[model samples]
Target: MSVRPLTEDQRDAMQEITNIAMGQAGSLLATLLGVFVNLSVPRINVLALSDVADAIGSMVGRNIEITAVRQSFHGYLRGEAIVIYGRDGCKELGDLMGYDEVLDRTDEIELLLDVSNILVGACLGGIIDQIKGITEAHGAGELSFSAPSLMAENVPAEVLINPDKLTWTHALLMEVNFTLEGRNFISHLCMLMPGGSIEKMRNILDEFVASF
Candidate 1:
């Protein structure tokens, strides 16, 4: 389905809500690892699925390979959340939590999935909870998540988000990256909602702004 883009007011409202959600995810990670989390201002875009790679690459770099985790969420607003970890992102995570040695292949994937799953649940649930409070439009629905699994492994950034494989045509993309101060670790949390859900979000955002 083709949908018109969100107006500037709607986009700004989305950016602000996404920022809060991002911070919630970051705070969870910081608490888990005992390290500070640096977050970027969240960006909200209504983009074609084919344009998603470019959007992701600009944030995490196209040349480097990434480790990613993917999970699906269902509720008032539905979408998939993909967490992209930089080349050394997982390694840095291991070090931060006091791992004495490099993790084995299975151990690495397990760790990656676990952390990303928690983050996806926190970030997406945060937005849904806040939006529902602001707008009763979707308040009746319950939020839930599927298991997070590996999406890409040492894969080039360009092919990580394969639009051709996705069934949706367009998405409302909200993205933010988390970094450790003075560390090479970087991970981007990207949430994409289909065109159908965008309509609900538009209304929710309007309600959110009016509530202020």
Candidate 2:
């Protein structure tokens, strides 16, 4: 069965929280890459694990090949964040970020991981701060993240996520993307939280709404 894990109020509040976080992420990326960053509206939903690949495709475009990295976060909040880059693999970013020579496969992966670390860390940090402010217990603990690792390279988005291999049936997806103005660089950050974390998000959000 299809699932909607978050109510409308929860979804909207989360979107606003993520909007603030994404803007922070974009600012940090722009400073790092030495290019103007374009931020997309945060898209929030609860979707089936089976449909995540298609949802990713819809964001990045149909069948477009991609490079991606993932970092898993745990603590008071839990989720895995996937950072997706387009098929050209961010040569533009390398140039803007002061890499004068062409990046070999290893160098490219390293660059992607560097960018992923900044984006995921700043974005999640912003959201966590807000959640801590609103969490009723006031003891909402901090989140800790694993180092970013390469997930997929130059693969079609449709095949990027395999549903059968995932442990969860449904996830709350919070997605946002950053684009570099006048450069061939775009990155989509998709944060997927399973049922346990979804319940935590719902509780925190309810407290937030009640306080206002």
Candidate 3:
């Protein structure tokens, strides 16, 4: 499916919305880890599934072992939200969460899911809340989502890029990076909205901007 690229104005508005959501997510992480979370400016882009890896590498660097968890959301818009952690970062997270000295594979997986649930839920909830606020303020319908489940983890980027895994040919990708101050931990949160929902989001963003 062909979709128009987002205008600068639209991108700015979306960036602001994503910034708000990322702030909420950062706060939640700070509370969970008992450390300050430094967030980079959110980035918005439209790209095909094949191009996602390059974008991620640009943010997280190259030749890193990445672990990601994905959760799908639906309502007025539908998409998948991914929380990615580098292998070393995952170990740091495990330590911060107070895991045992030697963690088995199962233990590591559990920790990853636990953290993923917290981060994904907080981020997606914040986004939905903002969207709902806009719609309610403008007298539009509410947006909602289902409970997030662990879709994949510790999977290679190449494995993840299989055509069968990506339901949409293209998506609007929003990325936000988080770093734990005084620690070696870094994480990237990415949200992908399909072309169909991108149009819906664009219309809603237009209405949102006009209201202000």
Candidate 4:
């Protein structure tokens, strides 16, 4: 049997679910960071893998540190989950941490790592646990990064720029943003699979949403 492409209704439905997930994440961030977290409208983008590089570059800007945290979940959906934070976003997070001394360049970077780790971990942890029905199953994994220069040496993920030539083979790419202090930030992104495993995740979420 062939899996059908997501209809507009299906896409909207998924977006709503993502909104709920991000709302929970926002609440967690507010509590953890001791400042209010504001979420913008949930924007959904489906793109080619190659175009992702350019899309990231345009959104995050060039000459910025990009830190990423990844976690893999099984049962409902099986794919690499990633949360990326830009350099400015990290700096704002450091200030929120209430460091006494002015953050030097090194201190800024280190504080950003800590902020990235906690915020990304909490955001993803909440969403995955709610979707999977097992709070304990969602565990944290080590985060890694590729230098911005390496992106050119590696694959170009600029999907939005060249939508026509790009293929949408992936199931879904959900992105949400968070603005803290004066900086614009993309808080969390989830790439969900459309394979057999998707049924498990969809069914569970469907029931959860229907109940409300």
Candidate 5:
């Protein structure tokens, strides 16, 4: 399928859907941390595979050391979701999660994976629920996701979805930032759906908007 840029209406609709999903995720994090969680408004974009690295650099900074956890989802739609954090942010997050000891590489990895599971699970669950509701209203099948995995240290953003094996040349990218109040911790959560899924997603969003 040929990839096309999303229309203004489609972009807006997708952003709205993502905002709702991230809000749900943020609420879960807040409850778990016993602190207020601030979530950025979701940003939706369509870009070629080669541009993904630049896109991530713009969000997390080019010089910062980073860690990421990736989880792939399949079913009605297929894609990967990544949660990224800077080195300092990772340490702060561990501290917030009740890990006060000096963390070695192993300890840090364990903490990162735990946090990733909670945040990614909540966010993906919210997104899937929205997709199911929209698709069911239009008589379409539902979607599901696999387990989340911790990627190697400082994994490049472009590798989050392997372009060589991808069925589509472009991806629909959704990103949101999460920050904790009175702390220096911040993380970016991104979801990438194959270019092929955009048309179907747009149709569902169109019907969803018409109902609103």
Candidate 6:
């Protein structure tokens, strides 16, 4: 089966979907952190396999501290979203987690996973509900893989997915960045959609935008 590459329009639509999704995420994050959260124009990119390391490297270099959370969801749709939080953002989060001091590398990872468990879950829930018409707009938090060392070590981890199950036929990596105040947050949506689902995703995204 030939992979149906996303048209520029589809990419635009996906970015819009992320804007909505991340807006909701930022709001929830604000409530969690007890700070006013401001979001910047989200940056979106789709990457080839070779570029993955470069992409992650650029983001991690922006700050010495990094925290990441990852969650996996499956049903009519299957994929994962790994949310990366910056060093200062982790500090803000550590404060929320009731740690009276800075989080060590391990502490940062745990905090990131916990926070991502909430924010990434909510973002994916909204997107899945909108696109798939599957009302299972929820996430079951599980630790597929996570490590504070992954961030503190300044090394990027490659995402592992069942390549043949990916919806786009090709293994597509959708990434978007969120900047609130002066801190940057990155959300990586790694979707493994079967080839049959792209059209449905387009339709759902269209309907979602029309309703807005």
User: lDDT score, residue 46, model 1?
Assistant: 94
lDDT (CA) per prediction: 0.85, 0.86, 0.78, 0.52, 0.78, 0.53
Q: Write the per-residue lDDT of candidate 2 for residues 1-212, one digit (tens) a residue.
A: 76866888888899999999999999998888777899899999888888887888898887688898999999877889999999775787777878878888888789889999999999998888777776536666567899999999889877888888889888888899998898777889999998888887898888877777
| Model 6 Cα lDDT, one tens digit per residue, 1-212 | 44445666666777777678767877887787666666555444444434444555564454344445555555444545656655466666676557887678677766666776666665665565345432233332222322212322232333222234333433345555545454444344333333334455555555555555
Q: Candidate 1 — number of clashing residue pairs?
A: 0
* Weakest ten-residue segment in model 3 by summed lDDT: 154-163
Stretches of model 2 off by over 4 angstroms after superposition: 136-138
- Residues 1-212 of candidate 5 have per-residue lDDT tens digits of 34577888888888887888889889988887878999898888888876766787787767666788888887767888888987787778667778778788778877777777888788877776776777776665656667667764775544444556665678888899899999988889988887667777888778777877
Q: Predict model 1's lDDT versus the native.
A: 0.85
What is the C-alpha lDDT profile of model 1 across 67-151, one tens digit per residue? 8899988777789899999878888888887889988888888889989987888888778768877556544567678899998
**What 10-residue stretch in candidate 2 is worst by lDDT?**
133-142
* lDDT computed for candidate 4: 0.52
Clash pairs for candidate 2: none
* 163: Cα error in model 4, Å: 16
lDDT of 6 at 127: 60
Clashing pairs in 4: 51-157, 51-158, 51-159, 52-157, 52-158, 52-159, 53-157, 53-158, 54-158
C-alpha TM-scores of all predictions: 0.94, 0.95, 0.88, 0.61, 0.89, 0.64
Question: Model 6, residue 76: what's the lDDT?
Answer: 44
Count of backbone clashes, every candidate in sequence: 0, 0, 0, 9, 0, 3
Error of 4 at 50 (Å): 3.2
Q: Which ten residues in a row have the lowest lDDT in candidate 4?
A: 146-155
Ranking by TM-score: 2, 1, 5, 3, 6, 4
Instruction: Report the Cα lDDT for residue 211, model 5.
Output: 77
lDDT of 3 by residue, 22-117 (tens): 899899899999999998899999887767666666766666667777777876678888778877876798888887686776777677777777
lDDT value, residue 121 of candidate 2: 92
Compute the lDDT of residue 61 as modeled in candidate 4.
53
Superposed model 5: Cα runs more than 4 Å off: 1-3, 137-139, 155-167
Query: Which candidate leads in lDDT?
Result: 2
